[model samples]
Target: MIEIRNLKKSFGSNLVWEDVSFSIEQGETVAIIGRSGCGKSVLVKHLNALMYPDSGEVIIDGRNVFDLEYISLRKMRQRFGVLFQGSALFDSLNTFENIAFPLRYFTELNEEEISDKVMEALELVNLAGTSEKSPAELSGGMRRRVALARATILQPDFLIYDEPTSGLDPKTSEEINQLIISMAKNLNITSIVVTHDIHSVLKIATKVAFLEDQGLHWYGTVEELRDSDNEELMSFVSASEYQIRN
Candidate 1:
């Protein structure tokens, strides 16, 4: 389980999270939803220790992630698989090379082993036939999947995604969410997603954390979101049709 207590962040004067607190259960999928700058992305960074909170704690599976030493922190970081909003694939690498990148960096596996792992990851993301293809040749959804494949190539225990369905059509967005959900269940990875997509919130979120008013507005299951009376969450959910806008 990941426990966050009284967490806070700021940019000199502008506070992001004020006394924020929440818990993410082991192997549970939690969605953090909010407006563009309401600290959703900041919160996910703290989970992987990419950014430190000004105060409070992030206890992941009983270990305080921020308090660990660099060497220990590196190991802790290995437990995380991350997908950024734009897929963020290296333009210089082909699909197979992109998937093999992490193994090359994080493991001492032989060439044959790396090859097999790359294939496994590609298959996991349903992009097996595109190994030799470049990022430029793939569609938006395919690029996103390649990034997902690389992120999970290590089979990390935790998955963190930022705006995974952003910029995709509604159908593609749902497909991406479905893939994310399938990956989570198949690997039993603890998944934390930061997105403004309500469709993602409704379809893939096992639990939801609404960040607004400089804090965690609400943290509970999808049922709680559906049944919530919180003004902020209600506003977000009801702002428009719950589908991908772009």
Candidate 2:
């Protein structure tokens, strides 16, 4: 489980957010939504300690992530898989090599073992035949799949997706959303998604967290979100022209 308590952060004198608190149960998929520059990305980065709060605690399992030693922190980070907003694949690396990067760095696996694991991850993302292809050779959706394949190659306990569907057409966005759902369900991985896509949120998230006014303005289940009377949340959803999927 992840518990964030009374979090506060700022850069210089510009405050990002304050009094942010929430808990994510293991195996749950929570979508963080807010206006652009509301610190959604910064907030998720706090989960794995890529960013630290000026005050408060982010506890993963039972340990405070910020307090861990370097070696301990490295081990803790290996348990997380992050799918960056841009897919962030190395253009020089082939799919197999990209997926093998984590296994090679974090595990004691030989080339044969890495190959086996990478192939399994590729198959999981349904891109089994594209191992030799570079990121430049794949379509946007295919590239995202390859990124996902690499993200899950280590079978992380938690997955963080930063704008997973940005810049994609609707069909491709849906495909990626389904892939996110499939990964979470199949691996029983806890998921934290920072996205602006409401459609993806409805399709993939069990819970919705709204960050606004320097804190978590709202946090609840998807059903509550759709039926909610909260003016701020309703306005945000309506502004996006998002209709809840029935």
Candidate 3:
């Protein structure tokens, strides 16, 4: 499990968050939601020690994140799998190479072993035959799935997805949402998903946390969100202007 305690962060004079704390148990999918510029992105970065806070502590599976040495930090990061905002695929690499990138860097696996792993990840995302395609050749939804393939190819112990279904058709969004949940179970990994999509929340959130006012507004089960009386979360769930185009 990951536990964040009394976290605080700032940029010069602007304080982003203070006293932020929450926990994500193993095998649970925690969905975080907040308005734009509410520091949601900043908080997720702290999960893998990508960014450090000015004070407080993040403990991942019993190790203090900030205390880890350089090599330890690198090893710590290997346990994390991140899917970025827009898949962030390299334009020059084909899908197979993209998925194989981390394996080639982190392990001594030969070409055949790497190919086997890449193919498994691609199969999990149902993109088994698109290995030769470049980022420019795939649709936005497919690119996201390819990125997911790349992220999970490492088989991280914990996964963080930042807006996994940001831009896609309704059907594709549903497919992506369901796959996110299925992956957690199939991989037996802890998932921390940050998104504004209520549909995705309702569909896959085992636990939900409302982030606002520089701290955790509320943290509870998905049923609690649906039947919530919290005003902050109500506003997020009721937000109606985030238009999704076809």
Q: Per-residue lDDT tens digits of candidate 3, residues 125-165?
A: 99989999999999999999999888888889999999998
RMSD to the hidden true structure, all candidates: 1.5, 2.0, 1.6
Candidate achieving higher TM-score, 1 or 2: 2
Candidate 2 displacement at residue 2 in angstroms: 0.4
Model 2 RMSD to the real structure?
Answer: 2.0
A best-first ranking of the candidates according to their TM-score comes to 2, 3, 1
Q: What is the C-alpha lDDT of each candidate?
A: 0.88, 0.91, 0.88
> Candidate 3: TM-score?
0.96
- What tens-digit string does per-residue lDDT give for candidate 2 at 1-246? 999999999999989999999999999999999999999999999998999899999888789999999998999899999999899998999998999999888999888988888888988888989999989999999998899988898889999999998888888888889899999998999999998888788889999999998889999999999899999999998877653332
Provide TM-scores for the models.
0.96, 0.96, 0.96
Clashing pairs for predicted structure model 3, backbone only: none
What shift in Å separates residue 219 of candidate 3 from its native position after superposition?
A: 1.2
**Who wins the lDDT comparison?**
2
Find the 10 residues in a row with the least total lDDT in model 1: 237-246
TM-score of the candidate numbered 2?
0.96
